[model samples]
Target: MGLLAGCWSAAATAQALDAPNVVVIGPNLVTSGQPTAQALARLSQQGFEAVIYLAPSSVPDAVGTEPEVVAQQGLEFIHLPVPFGSPTEGHFESFAAALQRLKGRKVLVHCQVNMRASTMVFLYRVIFEKESPASAWESVTRVWSPEGPWKRLALSQMVKHGIKFDPF
Candidate 1:
């Protein structure tokens, strides 16, 4: 039964790696929801080279010790600490800069439940990667359909980047 259990565990890992909320934006880029310490260790074991955390440590669900854990696991950790309702262009810029610097490394970008990560990744793809807005939007919507301030933040960044979106 150990073999069977191992198979089931592998299958579960694969499924989690393929979950819609774990958005693989590129060969080297992934965006996911907040992950526990165990999940961080697993990600390191699975060859993720770096983690960019967009959620503040003060966030209700944040694991405050994640940075230290990630470092102990030998994965680079970058913390940007975006607020839930008010993500700024500077935040996006920093994230984009980190991504550019880490190009070719397998990196995970995560925020609380992926809301912030997905939106930022969408903007990054459309603005910097030259991906079509429609395609980027598809990826964003797959994880979550942003509304209210989140939607406004996305739209504002799109405009700043000169990527037009129809409001209909």
Candidate 2:
């Protein structure tokens, strides 16, 4: 009976970890794809205190009224608007600053498909949180492998921050 109970507990934990469009990166942070209003409500129910959006409002899939929806759900909303074609260091800095300020708070950082969110979170974890580069890269790659300009941006930023990781 004890062994059966342990299996049940593990299954339950796996289910919680498999929330659609959401990835639990650490104790205080979660990354996600574009979330719907229902998803935001669910996040609130799950105790996420803040939501940081990296995608711009002009994006076709973005929820234009997300700020109001997030406010209604009682979650703080921040928009940094990093372009998919060309993410800048300034954008990274803003994201880092916001993440730093929100340290210890339950925060969700999201982009259109978790690409930007995961990369930004990877950099934050490696540089600011002093996490291992390989470990942080694992989380980032789990979403989407960065490429082209995005790849360049990530690599350059990592170099600037003195983070070293072998290309996977």
Candidate 3:
């Protein structure tokens, strides 16, 4: 009875939460939804060797503590607070660098709501992960609409990185 209840609870959790794209592109590349202690723990259990944060500065405490916890779990943690629409070359470059560093290691990159985080992940995959433009656009559109300023910036940055996905 207890085992059945646990299974039911897990199923409910999966259904209740927003279904962010959780994909395993390679031996170590994985993506998922928002960040939390339990989420990090699950990532750790699933071989996520690093946690990359792109959350807003206002909610630093909630997302910032993930690094410490990840360390304790014997995984690395890296935080990159990439505000929407103003992502610098340095930020993008550093993020790219981080992704390179975590190559061959399971990495879970996320934000508070996973919108910005997903965009960043899509850009990284498109540019650095060698994912095709079609795949990248599909991956990003799964979580973000191609409308609005934030999406505009995201598409433009992809172009800057030599990804030729159509904006509309």
Candidate 4:
């Protein structure tokens, strides 16, 4: 009976999180692909206080009304706009700053499909949150592995922090 309950609980949690490629690092931290307006409402119900969007609103698939939707749901929306083809270290700094301010609050960092969001979250996890590289790596790679510019950014941050982990 206990095993059955546990399985049911896991299923319920999965059902509750309906965003694309959603990853729950903990109760307070989540990363995902673009959340629809309805999904944003669900996130509000789930107790997320802020949404950090990494992709530019100009992206072909991005939701133009995302900011307004998040506001209507009473969640703070922070868009850092990391370009998919040319993410920079400075961009990471801005993201880190927003997260630092919202630290300990329920925050959702997302991009179109979790690739950019996951990589930035991985860096913030290892460097700012002081989590083990392996732990953070596992949290992110489950969504999508970083590559090219994204992978280079992650590797550079690791080097800058003097942490060692080889994902390549």
TM values, all candidates: 0.84, 0.86, 0.74, 0.90
Over 119-151, each residue of candidate 3 has an lDDT whose tens digit, in order, gives 667778778768886766665665667456556
Q: Point out where model 1 deviates above 4 Å.
A: 1-20
**Model 2 alpha-carbon drift over 4 Å, by segment:** 1-21
Relative to the true structure, how large is the alpha-carbon lDDT of every model? 0.79, 0.80, 0.65, 0.85
Residue 53, model 3, lDDT: 74
The full ranking of all candidates by TM-score, starting with the best, is 4, 2, 1, 3
Q: Mind giving the per-residue lDDT tens digits that candidate 4 earns over 1-168? A: 487775664455446766688777766788888877678767777778999999999977787888988898899999899889999999999999999999889898989889988889989999999999998899787887888998899999899999898787
Reference-based TM-score, model 1: 0.84
Better-scoring candidate (TM-score), 2 or 3 = 2
lDDT of 1 by residue, 1-168 (tens): 487775665455445553236766655677888876668767776778999999898887787888888899888999998988887888889989998888889888998788899888888888888898887787677677888777887888888878888432
Residue-by-residue lDDT tens digits, candidate 2, 1-168: 487775664444324533335666755688878877567656666667888999998987787788987888788889999999989889999999998998888888988889989889988888898998887888777778889878887888889988777564
Q: Give the count of colliding residue pairs in each prediction.
A: 0, 0, 0, 0
RMSD of each: 5.7, 3.9, 6.2, 2.9
Model 4 vs. true fold: TM: 0.90
Q: Which ten residues in a row have the lowest lDDT in candidate 2?
A: 11-20
